[model samples]
Target: EFNEVFFDGAVAAEVVGGEGDGWSVAMGLLALERGVSTLVQQIGFAAELERVVGAYVAAGSGDPVLRERLVRQWAELRTMRWNALRTLGTTGDPGAPSVAKLLWGGWHRRLGELAVEVRGAAATAGPGHWAHGTPYELGLDEEQRLFLFTRADTIYGGSDEIQRNIIAERVLGLPKESR
Candidate 1:
């Protein structure tokens, strides 16, 4: 199940960004990934936010708490967009990527939460009743799926703790956490 590459020679000509410059190249790519990719994700987030807003409106639940949370989510999305743009334009900020990651991860996870919460108790129910077929055969609806899938958004690329550590040590020039 494993294979390996054999570079019989120096392969200097095949190196990217010249020889011994891999770190800078890697960081550049990471910057694009964290900054540009976040902008792309924001488009989808906008749609998701709209959907949540739609659900909230349709349900007509005059819950001030949910309304406040929804408005805050919208505002945060805008803030994240501007932050990502700032990170994209800046250089020499090693923690920029981490900040973007943290911003979107938690924002998206909360969006998922809001998606289901807007739908209320029905969010927990599958698309089909158990009497129609086995429960596993009945898949989740959009809100349900959103709620489940976004649970990992904060965990996959990096956890909140890791992002905070990157900000603390790299961006703020604080002392490193003891391992």
Candidate 2:
């Protein structure tokens, strides 16, 4: 589902496409997400991201202060190519994705933390007011929910440990860790 964009296109006046295996597709999705994030950092916002932000600002429906804070925080997101160059000795190398993924995990986590903090709330504070003592009731507001979601960035796509290992073995040519 996620990698469809990479597979489909009109070639020579003919639509062409094919599905990729799950693992490869998932990996591509992770890389795509990181690339998009970096692009957004470089170009402010565009396409869907731009549309979302603009809609919020136009309608004045979302919290303006939070929006501004997020804009600033997003601006601080590391340049993907720069970080990749530092870690892998080159940009767009095989190891770049590993480094980018590692950075993304931390970046999203920090964005979540900062966004919630800017709103004078603790994102780490336990479930919001809801069915008290109920396991199903994990209290959280929108921003905190976002924080919780981004906290899993390290584990999703690929774990930080995995990315580190990729960098060590594939990029740095270190030996694989013993099982």
How does candidate 1 fare on TM-score? 0.82
Q: Which 10-residue window in model 2 sums to the lowest lDDT?
A: 44-53
Per-model TM against the reference: 0.82, 0.52
Query: lDDT for each of the candidates?
Result: 0.86, 0.60
Off by over 4 Å in 2: 1-72, 81-92, 121-139
Specify the highest-lDDT model's number.
1
Give the per-residue lDDT of model 1 (tens digit) for 63-154.
89999999999999999999988777677788889889888999999999999998899997765566357765556777887888888888
Candidate 1 residue 133 C-alpha distance from true site, Å: 9.3
lDDT of 2 by residue, 30-51 (tens): 5655655555543532232344
Off by over 4 Å in 1: 1-13, 17-24, 128-138
